[model samples]
Target: MKELAGQTALVTGGTAGIGLESARLLARHGATVIITGRSQQRGEAAVAELGAGVRFVAADLADLESVQALVRHCGDQVDIVVNNAASFPGALTVEQDVTSFESTFDTNVRGAYFLVAALAPAMLRRGHGSIVNVTSMVAFKGVPGASSYSASKAALESLTRSWAAEFGPHGVRVNSVAPGPTATAGVTAEWGDVNDELGRALPLGRTAQAAEIAEAVLFLASPRSSFVTGSTLHADGGGVAA
Candidate 1:
């Protein structure tokens, strides 16, 4: 789909896991891709792995300063933006205080929410663009032990809705791709051995590959989904339904 041949994209948390896979697909489909990650070496390695037509930016989603830096850099050239980067501080582990809750929200919500606020106007000026904010099935179903994570992602979905409503008139579409139990490095780190059990519980009886979910994002970002503003494409194998 060279439909995006002349376009530019910025994917956050794109050094590994789902972000890397998505970047590959977008670049292959003819979009010049720029991915972000905290690790300089990993970010470079990922760009290298994608071989060509892909670039890298350094940004830590947990740091507002880094987020600003990322936004400024990407503002230089971009038509599409994928807020695919996120962090989970474990489920239900409350700090029982404003500071702790804020710590968690800072990355999952504040960082991403404001990043787009800072960058989307540039898209608006371009007169056309698509923004895909990645959420999770956990945001819909109250996944056990993921209370905080779920709530944060829910906030992201909320941002998607409000932003789309506010910006759609400018020809900027905002949508989301909510993936479930994907095989990514972060999932491996967090879900561990229990991931296999979770997969068995899915209606499809298996977890989806990163590429499968990435493809969904590609569709939403492409003109094919021009009418898809403010909507969420759930690629969870019916996990939320079941």
Candidate 2:
């Protein structure tokens, strides 16, 4: 039997990159995976790629109303929720008359927070579940030119601990995965020339593959990790250790 047999999972930001990989891993482990993407087109494409027993939903994290709708649409108690959709609105962007902080927090932190809030009640009633926030090494070591985004991840990390404590007695676990620079399309563009600098400094000497991080997520989300909660798994290629 698959590790995740007889489970149902929801993965946010599942249209691309790490989220896509994580969702696929869960599906392969025998979970019915429902993935979310901002664009309907991309969501449909992602569902197609995931094959049978996999599905998609469209939810733009920046919008609270959309998030609520997405949760309601999620249907039934979910065994796992991978909060993997987030944005890195690099340097100096602003939202709602404030600064980039608002935009960054809205999508990265608030979206995940509210979605979990909506889902947790149902999960708790079911008496078993897991929540995995797709955080970044930036949450701890910090990343330049992405202060707002990093701050958002840091905030989510805090929530992971808090949620773990609050929900543990109910048999729900909340944890995080902080990945280093993975070779995603977005990261490929962000790398330019400085990417190698981090790799050289890292003990592993190279960025992790998306599937590597996805496997870590699967571990944390599985019964295999039932005793582990509130921890941040660093899939950072030793970036922080270096």
Candidate 3:
């Protein structure tokens, strides 16, 4: 039998990149996967591509109403929650505007915070669930032009520990996966060759693939890491070490 045959998973920002890959992995393991994205077209495309047992929900993490609507749609049967939706607006600290900074936190931190707050009660009631927050290595190390993004991820990493403590007693596990420079579609589009250049500095000498990071997410979401909680699994290509 598949390890996640009887489970259900909800992946935010799951229409592409690491989020989509994570959804694919969870579904492959037999979980009924629900993916969310701001674009209905992309969400439907993801569902179609993923095939049976995977569905898509339209949501905007930056909006509170959308988050609530998403929670309502989920209806409390999610065994795994992958908080992978985030906004990365790169700008130096002094050059960053208030709007972008707020938007970053609203989407990356507040959105995930409220989503977990709303979903965790159901997990607590059932006494078994897992939450894997997709953070970044930038949360630990300083990165130029990524002040807001890095701070938001750092907040998420902190929340993982807090949530683990709050929910672990009830049999729910909360952890985080921090990926370094990854070759996701969005990253490829935005950073172009810079990602490769950055990867060369890492000990592994290459940027990670989305699937590689997704595998880490899968481990944390699955029973394989049943004893692990409040931990940040670094899926980075040794960027944290270097």
Candidate 4:
């Protein structure tokens, strides 16, 4: 049987980038994948691209009500939840405002926080589940223009450990995947030709692809990682190592 033959998964911010790829992989493994995004057009497009049996739900993580609505809409008993929704507003500490910090935390930390709260109990009832949070390498390293983004991700990493501890005894696992400079549309738009410049600086001499980061998320969300919990997988092409 396929590893996720009878499972259901919720992947937030899944219309593009790593979230989209992760949802694609999960669905390919026979999981019923439900993806959430803020854009109706993009969500529908992603569902179509992922083929049959995959669903799309509109959600904006910055709104607590939307997050709650998403949970209620997804019904009961999701075997996997990927907290891949996040906002990245880059600003130096001196220039960062309350709005920046709150917005980032609202989406990255608060949304993921309440999501685990909402879905974990049902998972506990089933005595098995997996939660994978997509964080960033800046959470572990200092990035000049991304203070708020980094802090928000750091909070998520901290929650990964806390949730793992709280949910482990109940047979549910919580973990995180931190991606380094990855080749995605968003990144390419922000940092033009970053692969060659940043790639040379990294230990592995290259940036990562969105699919590679998705693979890391897949591992944590699968039974293959049954014994793993409270861990953070760095899919940075050795950026963290360097």
Candidate 5:
């Protein structure tokens, strides 16, 4: 039997990169996966690529109304949630605009918060569910141009612990996965060779792949991690340790 048979998973920002890979893995394990993205076109393409057992939902995590609508659409069928949607505006603190900072927080922190707030009650009632937040190594180690992004992820990590404590007792587990420099299309496009450069500096000597990070998400989302909660699994090529 598949590990996630009969489960339903919702992966935010799942049109591409780590989010898309995570959705693929969950569906491969027999979960009905719902992937969300701001573009209906991309979402539909992703669903088509992933084939059966995966569907797409249109959502903009930076918008509260969209987030709420997404929650309503999912209703109470979500057995797993992957908070993978985030906005990465890389700018020095002095150079960072207010709009960029707010947008980062709105998508990364506020969106995840409300999603959990709305979905957790159902998990509590059912007495079993998992939430895996896709954080970043910047939350643990400072990065030159990631002030807002880092802070947002740090906030999510803190919430992971709090949610774990609040929901763990009720049989719902919450945790986080922090990835270092990864060679995703967006990251590669934005950072160019910087990701590879950073990866070489890490203890593992290479940047991570989207699929590698998705594997970590799969572990936390499945019963394989039944006893794990409130902890951060660093899939960062040992960047945090280095």
Candidate 6:
């Protein structure tokens, strides 16, 4: 039997990249996966690629109303919630504008916080669930030209600990996966062929594939990780270690 048979998962920002990969993995494990994105077109395409047992919900995490609507639309309890939606606009502290900072936090931290708040009660009632927040290595090592993004992810790391403590007694687990430089379309578009640079800088000597990061998420979300909670798994090719 499939490990995740009869389970249901919600993956935010699942239109592409790591989110899409994670959602696909969960579906493969026999979970009914609900993927959310801001773009209906991209969400539809992702749904098509993800095949059966997968659906798309359009949502903009930056807006609280939209997040609430998404939660309401889900209705049923979610066995796994991947808070993977995030905004990554890099800017040095000196160059940072209010809009950029607010938008990043609104999407990355605030949205995730409320999402867990909205779904965790249902999980507690159901007596078993997992919440995986997609953080970043910058939360630990920091990064130039990414002050707001780093800060937002750092905030998420903090929440992982807090939520784990608050929800563990109820049989719900909250954890985080922090990826280093990943070879996603968005990353390549922004950094431009950074494989060699990351290969030299990271201990593993190569940036991660999106599926590699998704594997970490699946581990944390699975019964195999029943004893794990409140931990941030670094899928960062040893970026933080070095």
Q: List model 5 lDDT by residue over 1-242, tens digit each.
A: 99999999999999999999999999999999999999999999999999999989899999999999999999999999999999997788989999989999999999999999999999999999999999999999987888999999999999999999999999999999999999898888766887788899999999999999999999999999999999999999988788
lDDT of 5 at 34: 95
lDDT of 1 by residue, 103-198 (tens): 768877888888888888888887799999989988998666677778889999999999999999899999989988887778879777666667
Q: Which pairs, if any, clash in model 1?
A: 91-145
**Worst window of 10 by summed lDDT in candidate 3:** 187-196
Model 2 worst lDDT run, 10 consecutive residues: 91-100
In candidate 1, which residue ranges exceed 4 Å CA deviation? 93-103
Q: Report the candidate with higher TM-score, 1 versus 2.
A: 1
lDDT of each: 0.86, 0.86, 0.94, 0.91, 0.95, 0.91
User: How do the predictions measure up, each by TM-score?
Assistant: 0.94, 0.93, 0.98, 0.96, 0.98, 0.97
Q: Which sequence of candidate numbers ranks them by TM-score, best first?
A: 5, 3, 6, 4, 1, 2
In model 6, residue pairs whose N, Cα or C atoms come closer than 3 Å (at least 3 residues apart or on different chains), thus clashing, are none
The candidate, 2 or 4, that scores higher on TM-score is 4
The residue ranges of model 3 lying beyond 4 angstroms of the native Cα positions read none
Task: Tell me the lDDT of candidate 5.
Answer: 0.95
In the range 4-35, model 3's lDDT, one tens digit per residue, is 99999999999999999999999999999999
lDDT for model 2 comes to 0.86
In model 6, what is the error at residue 84, expressed in angstroms? 0.5
Candidate 4: misplaced stretches above 4 Å? 191-196
- Candidate 1 lDDT (Cα, 0 to 1): 0.86
Worst 10 residues of 5 by lDDT: 188-197
Instruction: State the lDDT of candidate 4 residue by residue for 146-188, as single tens digits.
Output: 7888899999999999999999999999999999888887667
Identify the superior model by TM-score, candidate 2 or candidate 3: 3
Taking all chains together, the TM-score of candidate 3 against the true structure is 0.98
Candidate 3 collision pairs: none
TM-score-wise, the better of 2 and 5 is 5
